[model samples]
Target: MSAATARATIQAYYDAFNAGNAAGMLDRVTEDIEHRVNEGAIRHGRALFAEFCSHMGVSYREELRDMVIFVSEDGTRGAAEFVVHGEYLQTDPGLPEARGQRYVLPAGAFFDLKGDRISRVTTFYNLNDWIAQVST
Candidate 1:
């Protein structure tokens, strides 16, 4: 696939997430997905991804906007830029306060894709900003 195509596909995955549909996001990825947030938090397989989604239920209710895609030269990889808007699910990990305050966080990700499946994903976002959003 072209870099642009890969980027578009990745963006669509987030679109599905924004809709609060974990199954939808899974549809865009390979059965064996690699999701990594830096080094310590690396998740593999679709099942794990789904479990992770469960945790997100408290914090994310399909709120994402301003999706932008950035592609590599060869199309083997790409990145996305967007903003997440939601109520602060303070109890959730990597997020903010539980009292449900309005929050916004800038997010980005790098993807290693094969065919239509995303084989690997390295996500980036500001934890501090997330805290600000969740904290009342």
Candidate 2:
């Protein structure tokens, strides 16, 4: 894939995410996609990704900051970096819950591409930051 295509695919993935459609996002990823979270190990397959999204539930809002894209020299993979701000609207036991008003937390993600879609995703952020904000 060309740099332009890689960048486009990265943007499209986020578009699907912002649309609150995990399946839609998964549709654009490769079948054996490997997703890694900063807090854990590898999460394989689109199905596992969907289960994660379901566990997290719907977000009331997300603020993406200085989002940038980087395509690998091989042209078969790409990565993205950005500060993601999210409001807790739904509930997830694995994650924190806001009891009043809302909260804004920073998040980030890095996805690898295979042809026209992402085949791997590595995410990074401070889970402790989220815990500190909601633990109260």
Winning candidate number (lDDT): 1
Among all windows of 10 consecutive residues in model 2, the one with the lowest summed lDDT is 97-106
Instruction: Enumerate clash totals for all models, in the order shown.
Output: 4, 0
Number of colliding residue pairs in model 2: 0
- Which has the greatest TM-score? 1
* TM-score list, all predictions: 0.85, 0.82
Candidate 2 structure quality by residue, lDDT tens digits, 27-70: 88898989898878688987888877776555445556677778
Q: Compute the lDDT of residue 78 as modeled in candidate 2.
A: 72
The residue-by-residue lDDT of candidate 1 on 21-60, one tens digit each, is 7788888888788988843478999888888877777555
